[model samples]
Target: MQVTTTADPAEFMATAGDWLVREPVENNVLLVHALDPNGVPPGDREPVFATVTDAGAVVGTAFARSPYRMTISDMPAEAAVALAEHLAKEGEPVPGVNGPTGAATAFSARWTELTGQRVGNERAQWIMRCTETTRPVNPDGRPRLATEDDQDVVAEWFTAGMRDSGLSPEEILRRTQHMVGGQIANQRLIVWETSAGEAAGAAGWNPPLHGVVRPSGVFVSPNHRDGGIATLVLGEVVARALEDGADACVCTHFLKYESMLAVVEKVGFRRLVDVVEHIYE
Candidate 1:
């Protein structure tokens, strides 16, 4: 097999699209394409690789970049080792991100042998799929579009969501602001409010794609934990997606979010897959 790298996002997306259709996952393929569109300049984006057989069939793929990270789609442990070895030899900086656990472990060992770097802590990667689409009864309030004036409040909630998910607050805020300012132009930030009109929960949506959109930043404050506000927010988000001509809405939450899971199920989302994220450091 031979591995070829490309900076062209179209080529990357073409390969990625095929991989996604063959093996669907929240983080591994879908979200990556949503975040980085084809035809766009690479910017700080990483290089993508397509592993091809001598007969000219694409076998597997991977992505890697500096200041961001590298990750592999589902592939054999041996392929992972070979890819890592190639990167190490090329002096490319390895990213501390996800891959299959066994593959990552094997590659890390190979990396250490080739580059003398040590593997750091490893964390479990969870991938949750949306199954059902139930809306909550008696939603506390209505879903409203957030305005520029609400930026600070939205930023705070975004930071809180990151903290709850064990992500870096600073990085979350930076990325949030960037997203909010860009392609998210079609997105609506929905808020769940109390009888007194106090905000209880919030969620964001990506613009619809192929008649589908992904829900993002779903968060309910601790005080609103048992209030079923999440279900309301989810319902509103799904409604918006439908109204915009979308057939389905998708989102992924860390497995630690039991409450969120319950809420999504209450509103008609069913479990699609359990995804695991492997980080390399």
Candidate 2:
């Protein structure tokens, strides 16, 4: 019934983590942020975390850092509207909203109504989960754990992905530098290589949370497209997670990435939910 904001990730998790885990696949993003020990990485934009509570129980949750859209799990439309009002009232600059279909739409509409901003673009994100991964029978490349030597290229590719999402340069640097290094250090980031030693593609899985591991930062080199590199790397990573005891492997991708969709399906992924990201003008 009331919206509250915090700077503490611990508080965010303490309040919202239980509700978030109720739908792990749908709330994977927030769960990652909440569980991340290396929080925010000195970004240019301040971090924001909020939860809607009624009688001491969390009912809705959202998190944001400027230059990046606010992200939430599924929540009541009224809860989403209250979140928009809370952010707007705080003079927080919300460039967009991303979440489940109804929640995202409600938040965007409320944000626009309060701020007089126009919705500019929208993207559909598919949350996919794979329990049984089908690796390439004869992949063009073989999977290997990334190393310090591979850091720059992996960071570069991930930054490019952040750019495509409209992230500001500073925020992109904060995220990729911190994220890529952490993933590589943990040996979770994997690169698919050609017999000739070319890095054809890369993918990584987060630490399992609630028995679910989300594979992310997936990318295939431009020259490697259509050679099944994405599927090769992703399948290998998810298969390893499952082998390591992950109950399910989840990931989200833009619906516009037709080729990636095909790759995911080939790796035995099926849709779990449809999410939306709405940008403002």
TM-score of every candidate: 0.76, 0.94
For residue 177, model 2's alpha carbon misses the true position, in angstroms, by 2.1
Q: All candidates' lDDT scores?
A: 0.60, 0.83
**Model 1 off-target regions past 4 Å?**
24-31, 34-54, 99-109, 112-119, 164-169, 208-212, 242-248
Residue range 1-281, candidate 1, lDDT tens digits: 55666655566556555654455443334335434443121224455543433345555566665534456665666666777767776777764546555655666777777876665545554444443354455644666676675566766777776653233566667656765544335446777777777777778776655445677677777787887777788788887676657666666545566766676666666655443454444
Model 2 ranges off by over 4 Å = 39-42, 137-140
Q: Could you say which candidate leads in lDDT?
A: 2
Please write out the lDDT profile of model 2 over residues 104-212, one tens digit for every residue.
9999888999999988999999888888875565544578899999988988887877776777776787778788888888888998899888998788778888888
Report lDDT (Cα) of residue 22, candidate 2. 92
Q: How far in Å is the alpha carbon of 243 misplaced in model 2?
A: 0.7
| Model 1: residue 160 alpha-carbon error in angstroms | 2.7
User: What is the Cα-based TM-score of model 1?
Assistant: 0.76
